[model samples]
Target: MLLKSPWKPRLADTEATVAERLVQALADDIAAGTLETGDRLPAHRELAWALEIGIGTVTKAYAILERRGLVRGVKGRGTFVAAYQARQGTLIDLSINAPPPILSHRALARSLMAISRKVDADYFTLYASPAGHLEHRRLLARWLETLGLVADPARLVLTGGAQQALALAFDLVCGRDGVILTERLTYPGAITLCRHTGLRMRGVAIDDEGMVPSSLAEALDSEGTSRRRAVYVTPTLHNPTTATMTLARREAIADICRLHDVPIIEDGVYGSGTEGTPIAMLAPERCLHVSSLSKTISPGLRVGVLLVTPAMECLATTALQALPFSPSPLSCCVIEDWLANGTIRSVRLELKREAARRSELAKALLADRTLVSHPDAYQAWLPMPREEADMFASSAASLGIAVTPPSAVMVAPEESDSGVRLCLGGASFDDLTRALSLLSGIGRSTRPL
Candidate 1:
């Protein structure tokens, strides 16, 4: 009988160097157990021929694997897997709302190098305008246009990230002692911001299509006093529920806000390329669109864009100035390079593909459960009773899996609508599969709280 081939590398076509790609393929196989501890890799020439690359590239890849302690090579023999031992108490975190790790170090290095070539003393010494650099603003405006949002660059402001953007929006629309209407189940960060700023949040009812229009209208109408208030909404891949508002739904919400003359703080952090035109387009005069590259691109980039109506631009910029600092010029340079060279597009495409794949996997694993998720969302919502959600979260924690607790997303602690959100992007594919299986099994058993 013919012996099985030593190894068949499967390279992912990400934005990485050939040597880096080769190393990644080998490392992935070893991690996935496709290559055993003692499995000998094919000869360098053999792999180079099979992969249609230079022998030097293959050699460089092997050196990297050895340095990473994933493989070992013998002079007379060939390279063998030397998989590292698993840590004793490692935790698999599934609570962070982030994209899968697809942006390679090589890609970031290339961007950094490009930035270095253009760096000057002013780049470090000067404080950027409250809205960030003018060129950066212009670049972001053009970028937003690709997502179906048209805006004047003058009205665009660069923030540290979406959190800061939200802060700026909240300050501009509703200062201290104001009320902001949000989904009954909303982002935890928003809840924290409200508490920290002495602003009150009123929860609005939601359905499969996000915030209900009638509920918002009622909330607006119920404002007995003349205190300032605004509507904050996430219309695409809503946190914890994966709800994307329909175009008609968005229009209705916009009309209500317009009728009430309430400004909208549109949190589009997870809104890039998911679904629906931004509500900002419908009511350009009163929407403050808050979005960041942290969700779609590298979070470490710390770059966010805020698009404000012309009337609100001055206030927004002033609020940013009151803050201690703005997005650094160095970070802005990376953003510019990424946009100019199409690196952002490549990373986002890979991220979307990975997110879709993970969502499918989660859906299949929990087919019997009530899971609310979108094909492009990095998280899946498993709606359950409040007690049941809490119990499940505890059980998952015991099994070394961390999930977002229902309370983290609830606008009010006493509300009955509750569920735990499983973020699919933070963990490895294998770890995600294992954790979901445990969750499915836990759901079936009558475990006590």
Candidate 2:
């Protein structure tokens, strides 16, 4: 039988470093269970010849792995699995929203190498200024131009992640005892932020198109005495529900914000997936667009970019002043190189393909269920029979399949829905396929209460 190879190596240069080859070999050993917890790895010379690399390279690779806590080299013996296995339990974690499948690490490694060659290594070691690195800002501005939003690099703030940006936006727009508006069922992060900041949040009703314009208007009117300052929304491929607002709805909402003098905090984290004009494009002067590389690029690179209007630049700056620095420069450089080269496009294409495949899998598995989802959505919203949501979640979890029940995402404590969200983009194609199959079996079975 052929041994399984978990390391997806890239064939770029023929003279690949010994470190690179050993990394692949080590990864393969870990995947094949040859290198279990406390299993001793071969010495530098042995691993070097096994991977066709120099002894020094093997040492360097082992050092890197050790730094990552994947191995530990003993003085007398040799490198071992550190008495700690990193690949424990299910690799498929469906709780968080991650980027599309990273099929190969070759492109990422190549990008890192390119950055090391071209950019100053020391630049990545330091903290970025408030406005971020000039080159990074320039590249981000150019990319934003593609989306039809002309960004003044000075007005842009590089955040640790989109969640930080959201927190900053809340700090700037909402005051203590002030109200912030969001959809009935929205991203949990936003809700949690409001709770943390002591700011009150009003859940606006949403339909198939998104937050109802009339509902927003009504909320604003009800809060007539208090300041109705900001509105948060995910207009494209929205989280959980996967609803994209129509152009007409976008215009109406923009008009409302303009009339009420409310700043619209548009969460465009998933904006890159769809091929439509952004709400920022509709009203750049009134919209503060927040996006991150986590959705499209690697999540480990915790970098988020914000585009604020000239009017709101002072507010944006003030909020960013609290954080006072940019994210990891090494991560930014990696992402910049990927975006500069054609790697990002290729990655996106692969992601889209993988998303399509997963969608097909979901359709086939949940053929008899009622689910609200997009073809490329990371999660699916399924409305089951009353009181069945909790049971379904429990049953799925019992089978080692994690799911987000309605209670987990409910806006109000008393207003729980009779449904659950089954995430499809959490694991590899095969793992997701098996999980979905098991979930489908559960969805189809009728249990007596």
Candidate 3:
């Protein structure tokens, strides 16, 4: 006895094939609330008969729906709508590594209104220096002071975002043929930038405390003294591994770089001022510190700051000038207002609370697994071999939970240490919980194909 399904979706009249149209029609009904949770669907044969389509077409659509987490099937019972479909179950993307939204629309509106009242037309029409306006530079220097980085305004160059800032740092230290030494697993952007600039990037070993000093020394020694080289490190809250270097390790890395006469590009994009002292402070003469407000404040706010030594100041400014344009003056003003009025501080506090909550949730849900995370970090890493990591990510994606693959974060293709990164900050708390629960189950399986 088949239960009658109330859904009678008419496929959209378009170029899509019969199967694709069926999938889209069912998806539309699910999203529009026409089909709801626990609502039983017609049997494959029944739907095929009613739609005058092949049974295989109906079967394909149903399989697609199940993989998308839109529907589910029981062993004895027929297929039914999944619970996720009722509550915005389009795609639970855990791939983007960013902080959760803590700022409200009202607050953003108020800030924008305040900025409009404070600035005049010249603020928008006038072209500023390549190193940014003097006042804006001072504001950034002052804010960095709160983070224990005593910066000089003259050495600071504002860029579009941390990504741009990183490119500037790479230009300052490494030229076209220069070599870059980084952790075994590093930020994906660095890998892309190296490839674009025709820079040779070599992977050094990393442990629980970020980059290993001994491996860094070996890599530097192998490059020899004649080659132009730089060492890039995220000493605080490393991206994929979530490893923060201790003070002693930072000193060791700085010492090695100094001995090799190589500059250091320290990326603190994930640091919140609480993570240990930056490596730049220890090797101020050769280190270029890069950070931005994307993670803590708003990802859309494209403002970043680069701190360079006095010796590299002129070269960095030249690099900035070489770019086609400068960072948005309006965006700079917004950051200035936020910093001066302590809006950024308040926002940071809120972000801390939200991130901590999510991190705890992820930790609790994946407690049994080998998880690497920090109390204040928005991302976590599950260490595994390459083959297993790929299998795990593939399985999670099939269930509509997107995660960062091991290849995206690995510096070297054949690097023995590899794993997938779980971005907990992007999804809602409920969705995060559900995804993590599913991941936990998938991890436990010996073969999660």
- The per-residue C-alpha lDDT of model 2 at residue 449 equals 37
Q: How many backbone clashes does candidate 2 have?
A: 0
Model 1 Cα lDDT, one tens digit per residue, 309-372: 8898777767776783367777878877888898888888888889999999999999988899
- On lDDT, the candidate that comes out on top is 3
- Lowest summed lDDT across 10 adjacent residues in model 1 is found at 8-17
| Candidate 3 lDDT over residue span 208-250, tens digit each | 9989999898888777867688899999889988899889999
Ranking by lDDT: 3, 1, 2
What is residue 362's positional error in candidate 2, in angstroms?
0.7
lDDT of 2 at 240: 67
List lDDT for all candidates, in order. Answer: 0.81, 0.70, 0.82
Estimate TM-scores for all models. Answer: 0.78, 0.76, 0.80
Q: What are the clashing pairs of model 1?
A: none
Colliding pairs, model 2: none
Return the lDDT, model 2, position 381.
76
lDDT of 2: 0.70
**Residue 120 lDDT (model 1):** 65
